[model samples]
Target chain A: MATLELQGIRKSFGTTHVLHGIDLAVAEGEMIVIVGASGCGKSTLLRIVAGLETATEGRVIIAGADVTRLEPKDRDIAMVFQNYALYPHMSVFDNMAYGLKIRGLPKAEIRARVQQTADLLGIGQLLERKPRQLSGGQRQRVAMGRAIVREPKLFLFDEPLSNLDAKLRVQMRAEIKRLQRRLGVTSLFVTHDQVEAMTLGDRLVVMHEGRAEQVATPMEIWRAPANTYVAGFIGAPAMNFLAAELVEGGAAAKLKAGATIAFADGVHPGGEGAPLIVGIRPEHIQAGSGPGSLPLKVDLVEPLGAESLIHGALPSGETLTVRMSDCSPLAGSVLPVVLPPASLHVFDAEGRRIEAVRRRERTAAAGAVGA
Target chain B: MMHGPIDATRLAAAERAAMKAEAARRRTDIVTHAILILGVVLFALPIWIVLMGSTHDVGTIARGEVPLLPGPYAVQNYLTALGEGSARTTRVPVALMMVNSFIMALLITVGKIAISLTSAYAVVFFSFPGRMVAFWSIFITLMLPVEVRIFPTFKVVSDLGMINTYGGLIIPLIASATATLLFRQFFLTIPDELVEAAKIDGAGPLRFFKDVVLPLSVTNIAALFVILFVYGWNQYLWPLLVTTSGDVETIVIGIVRMIGSEADTDWNLVMATAVLALLPPVAVVILMQRWFVKGLVETEK
Candidate 1:
């Protein structure tokens, strides 16, 4: 395994620029998942790292060697494409052995290597069959096996499981994760699905509009997002944002109007009476008539087998989503709910997290990061 | 009630008329087969005439005295033409000309199809500088026949000292625009996913072509082979211009020569040679009909 670094990478096709300057580092044996919407340059970045595409400006250092201008063959990396790309004419064994054969490896060595990889992938019986004879999941495994046999310093995957059905996708995702862990190879995986990124990566890189929005450990990104986009993107049923202001009443900073809630001294010291965007996770908001309870009008109730998501509106007419364990009585009725004091996240006018009074608790450690 | 009552005699006549119509329909089936047999006979007549004529004496042929059915099977005419028991001294028969024609046709067919497949692959897959211009330039040749450029092509061939050589016949006839464009259009439908997969598998351009593209292109190649073989085998004008001597003359030229030396034409010998020249192409078509039809029909899907 080896570390890979991309510094100041930019790409353009004629006048249309696809990637701005992007700098990222993949540590040895680490799995990095890049998540983004379509055309967000996530796939392009992965392709550049694989040397299937060249960056117009920048350097790619893999295993401490510059490979930016090299052809994909010389890059010493393997890629698993979305389509699986198994050689239709050859058996799975031959497809897996193609790279070794091209490099003039001996016949016995190539066969042995292919056999070992196939066995490890539990596709030994499938080795004799052509790609057309295999199922979608089998073909995907073959594609991964072809890459694994090479044992390159880096592995690139461009949404390898996107074509599979939901159940198969989940199964393959776990299989891929297990295989990657067993091999301990440095990998760069690209996907538009946030769940896959969260579940697979040691470090998840969220991208938006040709730039990295945020890069952190999955749990860290979930708990303390760098910005509103990361907070909204990383979780399901996304975090709800409500318009509010930081008002000065006493030594403790207080939020305006929803309910009487007091914070520790010096909370959000940016200024008083400043417009702010208050974000709270749906799962974090408790449903009850309590000290900080605020009346809400229920609009929709979604029971998802284990948990329920309640869609309701705030007094100010802003839509808020609340997640609960059981279906709420106020699902189709008006009711009161409370947001525990610490559960709320306040973002200043510029859409940045306001330095809370307990700054060192979350934002201080997560400062200097942006999504 | 009286109006509803029908006459038994009239009902019986109607039933008899229906039976007669069904019998007439069955009789037409026999008539149809008879006409089909007649058509087959008509098609085989010219071939039978040619085979019988090839064995008869030229004098008998010119006088139209040879029997339509196999007459006394004169092996002597063949022997004479083949320089065996002949009156003429040191006669060199026409067998060498047939051999030469066969060799030229094979070369042209193989050369044309090979070049066409590669050219089509380049245009369909690779994106390079001047790709559109290159594709259009080749495609435009489909509308412009070789006849239009024959003089210049002849001049170029002569300048290269290729006249009277196999190169003269092979080079000018190779690289067909229609075949190239046809193969390109067929190749365009192969899913891009296949190519992408090949690339990620560490197969470079040449490897991808040989392993992925070529394997899937079997049906198209078989189809193009028949097309190009017929085109090359039947080519007349260009070969006529290039091949100046009897040594290099093709089967068509040989058939044209069989009528010759003067105004009096040996129609029998001419037809006989024409029938002889038709065999190889017919054999090729019959041999690869399965693959040919497969190419034509399978490519649409």
Candidate 2:
């Protein structure tokens, strides 16, 4: 296991800049998932770390050595490509043994290592089968076995599960997590799926527009996203953003959709009547029946066996989605809902989250009543 | 319920029509196979004539009564061509010419494939300056074949003092644009991930070529061997212009020499030698036909 550090990595192709100064430090045995939509430069950053592509300006330090100029082989890393990239002409054993043979490992040692990795991956019976002859999941295991056999300082996975069916993806996802835990290898996995990032990563790097919006543990990022981009990105069905302005001496936000949410922790640092974006996750909004609560003109209902999602438009024409665990509100009807003050996230006009500074007794009482 | 009888009648009519259509299709298939068999017989008649004529004596064949039936002199005529030289013609033994032809064909096929594979590999993979220029330079030669530039090629070969040598016979015809173009097209179809995977596996360029490129190209190589072997075996004009001595003479040239001044020719020996010349290429094609088809079509990869 080794620590990996990427210092001020920037990449640009001609006039099209892909990454704008990405900096990160991965401790030993950490799995960091760089996740975003297509073309967000997640794969490019991983390639730079793997020495497959050079950064326009930065150093990649692995185990305290500068390897930015070294070739991929000299960098002592293994990458499982998005397509697996298994040698079609080689058997499973040969595909896993190729790197060791290239490094001039003794034949017996190579055979022993390949066999052990095969058993570890549960592909011991497939050592003689060619890549094309194996099923997709079997091929995926072979690809992972190939990477694991080398015992490199770092492992790079480029959406290795994207090609599998949904059920198999979940299976392989759990298997990869278990394998990474058992090996304790520092790894970087790139994907466009946020659910995968949330499940498989020890920490998540939510990227947007070639820049990392937030890099924190999965729960930390989910609970306290640094900006509206990340808050709306991590949770399913997305977080609802309302147009609002800071009122009550900058202690609460007044939504244009007809609700006022006070900061539960304390008063935020901003002047009164400043324009802001109020964020709240769908599951945190509690349905109510009182007249003074926010009115939602229900447009659709989606049942998910354990919960139902209510999508509706407010009086101000802003749409909101609410998740209720045991209620199914009918469409084309008015439903009353309450946005808990403790669950509200207030952002400035620039979409940067405004954190609370001081705890106040009155706002704490409000949080308790809302809960 | 009211439509049942009418539906049954309609179904009966449809079945009759289908049977008629099936009969017509069967008739068409019979005619098609008849024409195909006629074409095959027409194509094979000359080879059969040569095979049957090679068994007759020189007098019986030279008298313009080329027999369609077998004669008793088959083994003797073949032995004369194979073991001894024709007395009236070039006097070079057919066996020696056949061996020379085999050597020239083998060298040309192998040399062409090797040069083309390395060139295509370089053109497809590397990014050297003038890489496209070099590729287009090679591509431009496709339009200029051996016959088109025979005089200039002969001057170059002769200027290098390579006349009548195997190098002159093989090297002058080695720079094949077709094989290079086919290989380049195929190498392009190889996904970029394979190359990157090889690089990550610590395989250098030469090592990648040996371990990855060469093994992946077996079918294509086998396919090219069949075509190039025939191309080399049938080489007539270039070998004729480059070689003057019997030492480097090929079977094709020897066959031509055996037909000199028809009155003094040994026709049976020529026919026997011709049949011998056809055997090597046919053997190569038969042995490698499976790979040839696979290379041109669907593959496991």
The candidate that achieves the highest DockQ relative to the unseen native structure: 2
lDDT of 2 by residue, B129-248 (tens): 999999999999999867899999999999999999999998989889999999999899888888988899999999999998988888889989999999999999999899898899
In model 2, state the lDDT of residue A108.
98
Off by more than 4 A, model 2 = A289-292, A360-371, B1-26, B290-299
**Best by the TM-score measure:** 2
Please give the C-alpha DockQ score of model 1. Answer: 0.36
What is the alpha-carbon interface RMSD for each candidate? 3.3, 1.1
Worst 10 residues of 2 chain A by lDDT: A356-365
Q: Which segments of candidate 1 are over 4 A away from where they belong?
A: A249-266, A290-296, A312-315, A328-332, A359-371, B1-94, B121-128, B159-161, B186-204, B260-268, B289-301
> Per-residue CA lDDT of candidate 1, range A287-325, in tens?
789677877789888888688888887777788888888
**By DockQ thresholds, what CAPRI class is model 2?**
medium
Tens-place lDDT per residue, model 2, A1-371, is: 89999999999999999999999999999999999989999999999998889999989999999999999999999999989999888888999999999999999999999999999999999999889888999999999999999999999999999999999999999999999999999999999888999999999999998899999999999999999999998999899999999889878888898777777888887888899999999999998856337999999999998999999999989999999997897899999999888998888999999987666765787799999
